[model samples]
Target: MSVELEFEFEGILYSVVREFRGKAMSANAKFYKNNSLTTTGAKEVTSAIIKLTKMSKDAFMHTLFASQKELTSLSTLKNEDRKKMIRKLLGLEKIDFVEKELVEKSRELKREIEAFREVLLGEDEIKLKQEQIKESVTVKDAIAKEVLSKNEELEHIKLRERSIKKELELLSKTKEQKQKLFSELELAKNSKSSEILNQVKLSAELHQLEHKQEELKKLEPVKAEYTALQDQIKEQEKLKEFHLKKEGILKEQTLLREQYTKSKTDINTLERACEGYEEFVLNAKNLELNIAVLQESVNAKHTIENELKAEMAAEQKQIDITNAKIAKLHELGSEGACPTCTRPLIEEYDNVINSLVTVVNETHQKKINEHNKQLQNVVTQKAAFEAEAKVKEKEFSELINSIKVIESKLQDLKNAREYFVHVEQKGVKNKEELKELEQYGYDEKLHNGIKSSLTAIEAQYKHSLSLETELKRLVLVKADLENVTKKIEELKATCQNKETEFKLIIYDDVKHKHQLDEHESILKTVESKTALLNEIKV
Candidate 1:
């Protein structure tokens, strides 16, 4: 809660109040000395309050002027801007309503004070001076009291000064911003686009074009293959080049005749050597047949030897068994028993067992003699067959070497004959080609030049293919660049067009700026009202 300070100053009504919240303080001042307490007078009070609240002077002045343009309902305003015009219609003291007429009224009050002073003096002017001296003391005391009481109000004045300084600084900065922005606005109107916008657009176009160029790599496809094909064709033409020279034809013909004669001689020689080769080949075949016969005989003899050895082994085993049986029979005679039957041996049984043993021994010896003789004969036959097979192999090897030598000589002759034939044939063809060239008068220089360019022509063909692809890509690129350039042109024309007074964006910016100014004015109004409320609260 706050208390209002109402006082009379220079015969005019004045109200000043102070308020505080925490460390901050505010106050408001209203001069009601000019007019009666009517709704019309409330506006004057509001203007004074605006002044005392330390808001932007120019802004509030403008607002005050605008608000005072016409008087309207005060009750419609917010409580922060409360304005009541209470009339002093029934008053006991006939108190005066002081206003701008105070200057005129003050003259009257001065005359009256002078007349009353004269009346109170009652005699000597010196006595009046003495009374004036006493009154000066009281006046000094009153001044001291007023000064002591106005300390809070002085603080409010200081607060107002600080606020006013802040608003002044804000106003100055706003003025600078206005100058700078308006200059920029003029430049924007002159230019096609802002620097940033132009840079962005150009950079985008550069990037797109550069990216396309990078992506479209200019390369020839299979240059080496194309060149090789041309060289092959050139080589084929060179083989027919002999056909292009008539003077060289006679010389080539002479050479071809010689080559043909040599080929016939070589062919005859090869044929003779081939006859010898045939004889050697026949001998090798005969030796191979002999070797086959000998091998078969040797294989049969080896089989006989194996059979004889097996028989001899069987006879030897029988002899060993008979010997063991004879020894066992001797033991039986000594023991006088037949062990198998577990009975005493008779004399006739001993003779029978001995005779059986002797017969078995005689049979084993006879088979062994026959087996040994057969084995010896098989060994002799095998040796003879092996020796014959070896002689056949040696004869076959000699015949093979002789046949290989004869065949090599025949192959050499054949190769020489083939070379001669090839030379003769090529010469004949070249002779006919030369006759044809003589009829046509072929240019050696031109042919050589064309031959030299074979590889280059192939390379150019491949390069041309790459160029064709690149040209196609460039065509599309040109179209795209043209389109983009046209768009940029159109935009530039639109931007530079004198058809309108200002660009829409500039107008919008200006409009927003004015709106901000209006907001600032409203802010001052709100602030002043707040200050007044704060004072009233105080």
Candidate 2:
């Protein structure tokens, strides 16, 4: 005879075959995941079942496949053995271990608390430390005030020292000036007689040159006419150059005008294109904000759905445990002891079983159903938010594209405006230059006539310059002699004034040095006190 069994556990399907012939038995099993073979043979299948269900083979058998003979044998066992077996079947051994660990943790926590109490400060000690801090703060404040007063005195000393130094500098300058004026007075006195003799000679020569100058003065009109003609020729040359520059400017202005007109038209077109730019940008920003908000909503919903699914899985596991406990209770009957507390279940058997049923039905299963509903709701919300986000994203993309095009046009418009202004400024500068150029009025024929007259009188003009040069030398020598006499008298007066001024300024170098030393000593004292102030602590 052969027996085959098929079952599903934790979303996987398993197939088992057992054969008995001639008092020998053979067994094989296989499991599938997603309709594909995963494990084969008895050992592999057993291992896979243990791994999937998180239970040992014995416990799995006791919980799910206990036979009548086994149940009878379990009833006949000793109390301790029966209790241990039941505890293992119901997965309550971990509870005993957890209880032991909790007791140890409690003792550890109590010891830590005692240690912490030993190190904590008492109320009286805390108050004493506070008083000490308060006294330190008072001392620090007093020191700070003293420092401030010293700084004020130090600043006053610095001001007085500066004033004294300025007076010393003025005295030094006065002494130097007096010495310089005395030297100048000595040099001028030595040169005074020689300068007087030279002045007399220059006066005699000046008379002779003055008679020659009268002769040269006759050619003054011709020379003046020659100079005027040369000036006119130079002006005419400048005018010709100006005329060429004016033509170039006119050509440039014409090009500038064309460019300005074209730029104006382009600017108008660009302005029209950018008319609704602000509104489009605003709408795009709003859409982006909405999309971000929707994305957040979708993410939140996804998180909530995941949480709900996790909660449902936890609830389902709890329900499964409760159902297992209920089944074990039924199998133990009224004579069994509780698996968790190890109490006899004679009178409270129904109560224990009903309570486990109630937990599974009213608590765990109910929570699982609620979590399912919430998960479905969250999933639906996520889908809706995602759909809305997609639509908004599309709209945002379109808006961004439009904004890019508009921005490009705006940049073009900006460039056009800049070019237009540049052109306008260039035109204005050229017009001003042209206005200045227009002031030069040139007559070529009159210029030629003036050139001929200047050429004819050039010889007489050259002859007069020789006598004029000699007369200029005589005049310069006479002026120099008069300047020397005036300078000698001025130097005498300056030397006398400087000698009196030097007598009035009294600068004692020794006293100034002592004052500087005193100021430095005060500064060092102030710095030391300031350092002490900084070091003060509360």
Candidate 2 lDDT at 15 equals: 65
Please tell me which predicted candidate would have the highest lDDT against the true structure. Answer: 2
TM per candidate comes to 0.38, 0.39
Q: What count of clashes does model 2 give?
A: 0
Candidate 2 local lDDT, 1-538, one digit each (tens): 6666677776766666555556556666666665677877778877876887798976766567766775787888999999887776676888888999999999999999998997899999999999999998898788888778777776776676677667656656765666666676556555655666766776677678778878888888878887887887787778777778888999998998999899899999999999999999999989989998999999899889888888888888888887888888888899998977989999999888887888788998888888888888888889999999999999999999999999999999999899889988998999999898787666778767877887898888887887777777866866776786676577566657656765665556676566567667766765775666566422
TM-score of 2: 0.39
Query: Residue-pair clashes per candidate, as listed?
Result: 3, 0
> Which residue pairs show backbone clashes in model 1?
2-538, 3-538, 243-433
